[model samples]
Target: MIEFTNWDILRNLLLAARWTIALSLTAFIGGTIVGLLLTAMRLSGRRPLQWLVRGYVELFQGTPLLMQLFLVFFGLSLLGFDISAWAAAAFALTFFTSAFLTEIWRGCIDTLPRGQWEASRCLGLNFKQTLSRVILPQAVRVALAPTVGFSVQVVKGTALASIIGFVELTKAGTMLNNATFEPFKIFAMVALIYFALCYPLSLASQRLEKKFNGSR
Candidate 1:
């Protein structure tokens, strides 16, 4: 067994943590974009579009994320597409993120008073104009706290990417444990690193919720 110095183990884990951060950010941003589109479709007042969006959301939200990652990684190969682990992880996580975010944002939008929509329509604002100028602004404020909170979930979910051979923090921890035969030490450090990344977001989410509630 190769003995890894404390510093060596930490440095490697820290380097791997960068990939975790990158994957989380990529998934969040891509998911946000897709989620917005899904939200628009749901709100479009067309039954077909709404049904499509609803089904899409349900399909992803109902399934296990680990399974989604597995499908993205291996299913692509079976279809004669060669994809990297990074791509597979990002693809799966983006859809997973989008599904949850769509529901979160939808709840925020639904929280708006019915009178707000009526008032906008009475003012001759079209659907797009009213949504852009009036409804979305308020919804965004309501959505911000929970969105930040859900981001912690996204960060944690990146750990599953390790199953697909993506060498993020969890993967690096596994590799170091194998080399150093110190699963407890390696995993504890991994947990600490994840906490360091996620705790502030949790605190901020709580603070935002409190602030928003107080303002109401």
Candidate 2:
């Protein structure tokens, strides 16, 4: 067994943590774009568009994210698009985040008073204008807390990428533990690292939720 110093193991894990943060940011940003498009489609006038968005949200959110990662990794290769596990993991996580975010934001949109829609219609704002100018501005307050909260989930979800051999923090810990034969110490460090990453976001989300709700 290799002799592993705590400092050596920690240095490697900290380096690996950068990839986890990068992956989470990538997924959150990509998912926001996709989720916005999905929310628009789901709330669109056309029934078919609504149904299509609904189906997509259901397909991703209903299934396990692990399965989605495998499908994107293995299934995409079968389809002849060679993808790195990094690419596959990022893509899968983005879609997974989009599905949940679309649902969350949709609920926020739904919470607006029914009168707001009628008022927008009365003022000659079309659906797009009303949503962009009137409804979304108000709904944003409600959406902020949940959206921030969902980011924590996205960060945690990056750990799932380890299963496909992506060398983010968790994978690094596994490899270092295997080499050093020190699972307890290695894993404890890993958990602390994850907590360090996640806890701040959790606190910020709670604060935002209180601020938003308190304002109302």
- Per-model TM-score, in order, reads 0.98, 0.98
Error of 2 at 29 (Å): 0.3
- Candidate 1: segments with Cα more than 4 A from true spot: 214-216
Q: Rate the local accuracy (lDDT) of all candidates.
A: 0.96, 0.94
Question: lDDT by residue for model 2 over 1-216, one digit each (tens)?
Answer: 767788999999999999999999999999999999999888787899999989999999889999999999999999999999999999999999999999999999998989999998999989999999988898899999899889989999999999999999999999998898889999999999999998998898899888999475
The collision pairs in model 1 are: none
Clashes of each: 0, 0
Scanning candidate 2 in windows of ten residues, the lowest lDDT window is 207-216
